[model samples]
Target: MDTIPAILRAAAERYGDQPAYVEGARAVSFAELHDQVRELARRYVGHGLAAGEPVVVWGPNSIEWVIAALATTYAGGTLVPANSRYTGHEVADLVDRTGATVVMVADGFLGRSQVQELRAASDLPSVRAMGELSRLSLDHRGEERHVREVTIDEVEARADAVSPDDVADILFTSGTTGRPKGAMSAHRQSIGVARAWAELGGVSADDRYLVVNPFFHSFGYKIGILVGLLTGATLYPVATFDVDQTMQLIESERITLLPGAPTIYQSLLTAPGRAERDLSSLRLAVTGAAVVPVVLIERMRDELAIDHVVTAFGMTEAVVVTMCRDGDSAETVATTCGRAIPGMETRIDAPAGEAGELLVRGDYVMLGYLDDPAATAEAIDADGWLHTGDVGVLDDEGNLRITDRLKDMYISGGFNVYPAEVEQALMRMDGIQDVAVVGVPDERMGEVGKAYVVGTASADEVIAFARQRLANFKVPRLVETVEALPRNLSGKVLKNELRK
Candidate 1:
């Protein structure tokens, strides 16, 4: 059961009547989920979706999103997820690059029509069909007017045709140095990584997972959705992270497994009326994405009463590289992302305890970047190790501690913010001569972007200009004007000086 569909089938046989997914008023058992996914896969095949084709799913975290994404793979099509916060212009670039034939959007999310936004952004000549994700009902008996009708046998045939080595997803991750590149992962790699994470966390069928991370990310998709499929754990998806709502869900759902960025725990620790909330049900807590203070990890165990609090480090290319164990000390969990999981190897380029570029090679590393051979070659060397642009060191105990980043990228509320991308977007504004963006410390969001501009445009005007072009998280939160940006002999902006 190396493939997702195979794992799903196994889950159905093992956990049949158990609740697999619970959304608001709807709940689907493992057996029912399998049937629904197959039915939707039939719809995809009926619409002439060829094997190995790409389908883009642009929506928030929901049962419909889960079904649609799995159905794409079940129909032998590649799943390309679009960030819900991405503007239409951004999504259009991805759809065009992937040559996606179909796009399913969550229209009217956050008060914007996703379909209309993509339409206005580009004609999307490669896209042959577009469907609203909200209309995709899991009920097999309900009417679905979007896709063509096909037989269950046809869907089963398509699923059988899909091999474990075939491409399952092409997740687009922004490069700190350049444009976003689609990291391709096969079915085996995706399922393998999820299985590793589930095993490390000791995830079980009875554990209720509260997923606050967006489904588009590997954290929520591979670890959140696929982990449930492999372990039979029931998943409760949270589209947005409202502290009050999340606390309420934890108590009401009796969630046992909760994994998210450090900010989520910070919010919960300081959230209003938190003492009254019964959070004793929480057992396993995994957090990462930004620096985790030792105090935060200690507080989570003390105040929240969670038994296991661990941390992990991962990227788009390799989903689960290193993770802390169940009984790891609070200081160890806070300072280091634990040893590499089984079937993976890690090494620092410098001497033993010294910080250097961290390199990883494993069974779960991405095959390569989609249609970008040059970039792919540069990333993964001939030796087969992927050069992760992060600076870290390995302690004597084999724990990997990330000290610095080679790339000027930061995490804001668990979202990767590449400074180069923000700088490029800021340059588009008129009267802007030069700009340098740096990640500044923020208590709420792990880090926020602050732009240093050497231009005539006012800070307010520059920020306003970026708001329309980039996503809210990508936009710079603060702006400062300088006479000129400091540059080195090689003409690279000295971001360190700007940070000072």
Candidate 2:
């Protein structure tokens, strides 16, 4: 079961009649999912997609997106999930870079015709556009006798042909630092991470996972879909994170597992009608992608009634390398991300207790950025460590606490300011709900810190409060209140956007 098709076949047999995926009122059983994947595999093969070829599944979170991704593997093709928020130009560029032979996109998502928009923006060069399969009812009459009939055995046999070294996916990096590069990973790598994620999250067959994170992001796709497939859990796909609907789903659907960014939990805890809902069903929570406050974790456990609130640190290139364990202290879960998972090794470049770049090495790391040899060489050094540009520290107990991105560290006067440290300090202050700090140009001192507070605190008051807690040089020179900070689909603060 190192390959996706192998995993799919095992799940179908093991889970049988159990529901594997649920989208609103509709549910797809394991047996049905396997049948549909095989049927679609036939369709894909009929259209000439083969092993090692790329097929871009571009759409939001839905059952169709899931099938499209898995079916590509069943057809022995590589999956390239496009970010739903990508503009036409971005999508076209990605398609071109991947040399994708087929493009399966949602006909309409969130009320917009994405396929039409793509056609309008680019000619799409030489790719086949398959309209949304969200509601596709395949009534294949086996009319094409030339195309071989696909069965579970045949699918498994074909999956066997796809070697562990064959590229399973080419997930593109977030490109916050530079241009987005496709990070290629093999079947073994993908399968390894899937198992590790399930084990770390304590995912079980009886658990019902509410996936508020989009399918395009690694956390949602790897942990959300792959983990469910591996563990035989039921997956509830949530297209967007609406606090009211999510609260209702947790109550009515009896969702036990929910994983997303800190902002999602923050929204749920502070949501208008949250206290009135019966949220006692939530048991496990995983959050990352920003500075997580101790109070947030405490509220998620105490108020929301979630039992295990774990924090993890990962990126697309290297999936869940580190995660807080079940027996970790609340302070450990709150302050640090976690130690490295079983198969991987994590090291920081700086001295112990000092922040430096975090490096990871193991089966979890990607082969390299696709087609960008120089960049790939630079990322994964000769020593076999992937130089994660993220900055963090390894405490005495080996817990990893992320402080800032190497690119995000800014110099102020003669000192360096990690925005995450500044934000964490501001989060502890009263009347501040959320905060993001960025270095702004200051004639007096090369670059000074500017804080964006999402609360009722005034600019002058916040600056004064920070002055008392922080060193004179580290305190923010300016503070501004905003309705909300601009964030990417993954809920990471777009400090680059804030700078503009």
Candidate 3:
């Protein structure tokens, strides 16, 4: 099987001068990108990073980010991207789990530096700063090896030695059971995701890709970086998701593809000069992490003039189970998250209703969560059916519809209440823009619902509005109105933070 770097070699041979990645004022051609990966991989090998070992890639999206990722694959090392938002302790835990011998990071991001904080991890392999990495040379292998450069032959020959089943990345995902688990993705399967995305979307070398999702995320790291590489599509890296900045870049660059969450889109819509901006170059858009309401789809198609909107579903495991297929009706694209991708088995279990734990069985499933065998056993069964803790169902045509998340369900006065239901109910109310419902501890009922709302309505007004429709028990006892609720990089509600 062709390794990840081999895809670049193909692009280099076929479309050498074609621009492969673009960031700010720079654009890297396919041939140039490949050479950079080759040199960087050689540098990695020269530094003594072996095939069986791993390297921690921590930083936001940038041209260097993709270079480091591909370089790791070429050098035959597992790529473990530490969460950019991770605390020093959290990063330390990931480093320990991956057993990375080298950590590659970008320069001072957001003025709050990381190189120093990450170096403090006693368990760290070696800290390699971005500023130092730019100066990496392979000639001297051992002259202060915390971050040295290695050669093309050394990396490519090892790349030739690497196989499909080799662990490519250890992506840590927050599990429903409290602690996070590291999901191992293999080389071939990583390519499978890339291939599935390209085939589904018909992405080609002509496309200019804008990656707004965090580089650490599987959706962005694997599908965006790896898949974009496979297709020879030029990558436009966004370090942050500022609305005005994103809009300006889109209009200026004419970015052909955008892979981001709904919140990012929402933010961009609200940006000043947004309606006047010329975004005709954006041919395709992909959004996930949360359900995309029909209204959002209408807005994108009507307002943004995007031709196709792909709603994808999957975590680190299962790669991506289902997506709204090309030419699907707007309703399906907006509501149902389409059928299973090739080589993946998606089922609704006993009865396909409005909601259930979405079950999947596939080779793409993670080898197991890093050092969490008990949790691994609970998530992925012996027969290899990954029991996704998310609550969803298969619609009439078998399209997967995610209504609520299993763990996010709260018990209110002995009645189990899924927050999505309450949130959906709240979303229907006039002047109620966004809603996040979480269970607050209550002595009498064990737990009562509390809503953290964003937008116009005040606490009393929103509660009174809810009381008109919902039963007394279902109404939120304590409504805390806020400008915005905390969310993960993927735009997933940080329920844990709300609980805290």
CA lDDT scores, all candidates in order: 0.90, 0.80, 0.75
Better of 1 and 3 by TM-score: 1
Q: For each candidate, how many residue pairs have backbone atoms clashing (under 3 Å)?
A: 0, 0, 4
Which of candidates 1 and 2 reaches a greater TM-score? 1
Ranking by TM-score: 1, 2, 3
Mark the 10 consecutive residues where model 1 has the least summed lDDT: 137-146
lDDT (tens digit, per residue) of candidate 3 on 1-500? 55686776787888789888777778888889888888888777766778867777777788787788788888888888866655555566677766776677664665545666655655364433232333333323234645444455566789888888888888876544434578887888888877987889889988888888778888788778887768878888888777777778888888889877676666666668887888888889887666566888878888888888878887777668888876888888888888888778777665646466788987577787777788889988878889987778787777888876667866543334556656766787877878898988775455788999888888888888776545355678898878888988999999988988
- Model 1: lDDT equals 0.90
- Lowest summed lDDT across 10 adjacent residues in model 3 is found at 129-138
44-109: candidate 2 lDDT, tens digit per residue:
766556677898887778888888888889888999988775655557777888888778876666
The true-structure Cα RMSD of candidate 3 reads 10.4
How many steric clashes does model 2 contain? 0
Tell me the TM-score of each prediction against the true structure. Answer: 0.97, 0.80, 0.79
In Å, residue 230's CA in model 3 sits off its true spot by 1.4
lDDT of 2 at 148: 42
Query: Which candidate's lDDT is highest?
Result: 1
